[model samples]
Target: MPKLWNETIDAHREQVREAIVNVTSTLVFEQGLRAVTMSQIAEHAGIGRATLYKYFPDVETILRTWHARQIDSHISELTQVRAGAGSPGERLDAVLASYAHIAHQTGSHDRELVKFLHPDERIVNAQNQLREIVRQLIEEGATAGELRDDVDPAELANYCLHALSGAAELTTAEAIARLVALTAAGLRPPQS
Candidate 1:
């Protein structure tokens, strides 16, 4: 198919997915994950239960799918950050800035996203992956003399990535700036 035709299909898919996501998020936020049944999601979305089942067999599946998608989106975003080609401090700052931007975008007025990712095993896994990536980024920076050599990159990455979970509740760009300051302080090269 032509690129335009593919784009149209993708657009439609995105719309449908958004509908599903919005309805599920609302239900989860209002009623808690266990209370939000697939039938409820179907009714909320104005789709048949069969259609809902076709998209997601169970609520856990929906949560996992959404979580994975969120992770993949951020990973792809971080990949772009990596490509910018800068010093450790510059690259780290850019990455943190991008992360803060994504956090703002992911924040929902209904508080569904926090309910989804809040302080749980699923979130732990997501943060673990993020921490690993941050560690790797720091390692790269350290090798390039962009970050402090003495601090353990893994430890610092865990601190930074874990700290970012608060972005769910934070409403302003100032929150991101605060995080950037914290992250930069942790990453700055120690005086010899």
Candidate 2:
């Protein structure tokens, strides 16, 4: 019984997990993704290669895990942005504000995420989901007559997503402004 309790606690040791994640994030940020290896991660994580394997099977696993966490966070933020009451345009601006914050936080973690993105199928799916989220918001905005009807919402969303991602290079304030302007331009109702 004591061993079982200990085992479970050890499994959930947040410090260890964070140490691994931080080490890897830092490595990728500084050296780019290709520079890091499982052996290096194991070394930086202060664990043996075999031990690290017990936690994550491969480098791709760790990368996917980190990317998934960011995606999950983006989803949560979107949920809040959607829940808040505002005009469709206003809500999109609000959501983009939140996204800018996320993108700029942690030494531009989002930028690092962009840099490390692998050409994997899963990464493509993640990008699609983000685009879809943007598209849906545009659609809702258009339905509210807060957006133009001429452009396809899906295409607009995809374009805005790329635009916002490109703005990740800017300061948070700059990114927010850019996002606001871009979204407003995309969503502004047709001239009467």
Candidate 3:
């Protein structure tokens, strides 16, 4: 095929795949994970069953792909927040607040969906990525005398993550901000 033709074909394939992932996500959210079927996804996405099968072998695969995409997007956002121009403390605060906001947004997902997705390897890797991002910031903050150095940065990173997870249960932005503030406070050195 000509180069333009190949590019067009690839673009079309990407669009179709995106549609499949998005339609599957909506169906799963509306019908519950176990209740959603590949056929329903195909019909809802305006694709044929055979095309859907060609793209994804099962509903679980589609769901996993959708989740992986979400994780990538989130990690990318966190990375941007980390890289943004700021002092170590300011950057750390912004990243934690961004993460807390993410938790609040996704907190409404069904418990069943959460259970199904939590054990995947992608989740493990994403957690590790999050930890590393926070750990690096903690190290920088400690060097800058902005955070406590008595504890290991790795441990403090875990502390921040675990403490900020409370944002998930929060009902208001004010509550999430408070949770982030409290979590950030825990990283500070004791006053003389």
Candidate 4:
């Protein structure tokens, strides 16, 4: 096949795969994970069962792929937020606020779906990346005399992550912001 023809074929395959993923995600979200089926996804995606199987072997694979895509998008968003021009403390605040907002939104998802998605290695890797981002910011803040120097950055990063995890339970944006503020405050150096 010609180069353009090959590229077109690849693009079309990607589009079909994305459509399948979107349909599967919507069905799982609206009908519950246990209620969704591979045939349902194929019909909803407007693809035949055989075609769908060519893209994914089962419902679990599709859901895992969808979750991985979501995680990648989140990591990219956080990376951009961290890269924004600001002082170390300001950047940290922005990243934490953004992260808390994401947690708040995701908290509304079905409990079973969240539980099902939590055990994947992709989630673990994404979490590690998040921790590293926060740790670097904490180190920068400490060097700038903004955050406390009394604790290791790794320890403080763990504290920040654990404290901010509560944002997932918050019902309001105000509450999430409050949680972020409290977590950020905990990183400040003690007053003389």
lDDT of candidates 1 onward, in order: 0.74, 0.71, 0.92, 0.92
Question: Per-candidate TM vs. native?
Answer: 0.69, 0.74, 0.97, 0.97
Residue clash pairs of candidate 1? none
- Total colliding residue pairs, candidate 1: 0
**1-192: candidate 4 lDDT, tens digit per residue:** 899999999999999999999999999889999999999999999989999999999999999999999999999999999999988888999889888888877888889999999999998999999999999999999999999999999999888888888888988888898899999999899889
Cα distance off (Å), candidate 1, residue 169: 4.1
Candidate 2 — worst ten consecutive residues by lDDT sum? 103-112
TM-score quality measure for candidate 1:
0.69
lDDT of 3 by residue, 60-169 (tens): 88888999999999999999999999888889999999999988877888779889888999989999999999999999999999999999999999999988877889
Error of 4 at 161 (Å): 0.9
Clashing pairs in 3: none
Poorest lDDT segment (10 consecutive residues) of candidate 4 = 100-109
TM-score result, candidate 2: 0.74
Give lDDT: candidate 1, residue 102.
70
lDDT of 1 by residue, 31-76 (tens): 8766888888889888898877767778866766676677778877
For model 1, state the Cα shift of residue 158 in Å.
1.9
